[model samples]
Target: MKVAVVLNPIAGGGRLKRHWPEVAASLKRHFGDFELRETQAEGDAERLALDLAAIGFELVIAAGGDGTASEVADGLLKAFRESGRT
Candidate 1:
């Protein structure tokens, strides 16, 4: 299964950035392999997710707090809406 990981490096004051190596390994163990996309700034995750979804990502995962998750969801919704998918 192809998976997309949208990670916010600045989340929790750079906690994700510090522990990403181990975290990525753990995710790999479970998900096998994934496309990792780092956020350059706020809303980058959303834009990235939207682009991924548009290209046919079956699963998209978002890291960070609720804000990041919300943005990702919004992007996915917008993509689906624009595509006219039910």
Candidate 2:
């Protein structure tokens, strides 16, 4: 499967960023090769996820708290809506 991960580097008091190496290793082990995109600001994850979806990524995983997940989902939804899938 084509997988993309949208990570918020400073989420959860930076715990996610600190643990990302191990997390990436586990994801790679289970899912094979995947793309990782880190958010630099508030809207970056949404934009990245939208682009990823537009290019036919099968999955977009949010590696942060609820806000990141929501942004990713919104981007996916926007892509789908624009493509007449919804």
TM-score, each model?
Answer: 0.91, 0.95
Q: What are the per-residue Cα lDDT tens digits for candidate 2 across 1-86? A: 99999999999999999999999999999899999999999988899999999999999999999999999999999999999977
Candidate 2: worst-modelled 10 consecutive residues by lDDT: 77-86
Candidate with best TM-score: 2
Query: How much RMSD separates candidate 1 from the native structure?
Result: 1.1
Q: Give the residue spans of candidate 1 off by over 4 A.
A: none
Candidate 2 Cα outliers beyond 4 Å, as residue runs: none
Collision pairs in model 1: none
Q: Kindly give the stretch of ten consecutive residues in candidate 1 with the minimal lDDT sum.
A: 58-67
Residue 46's lDDT within candidate 2 is 90
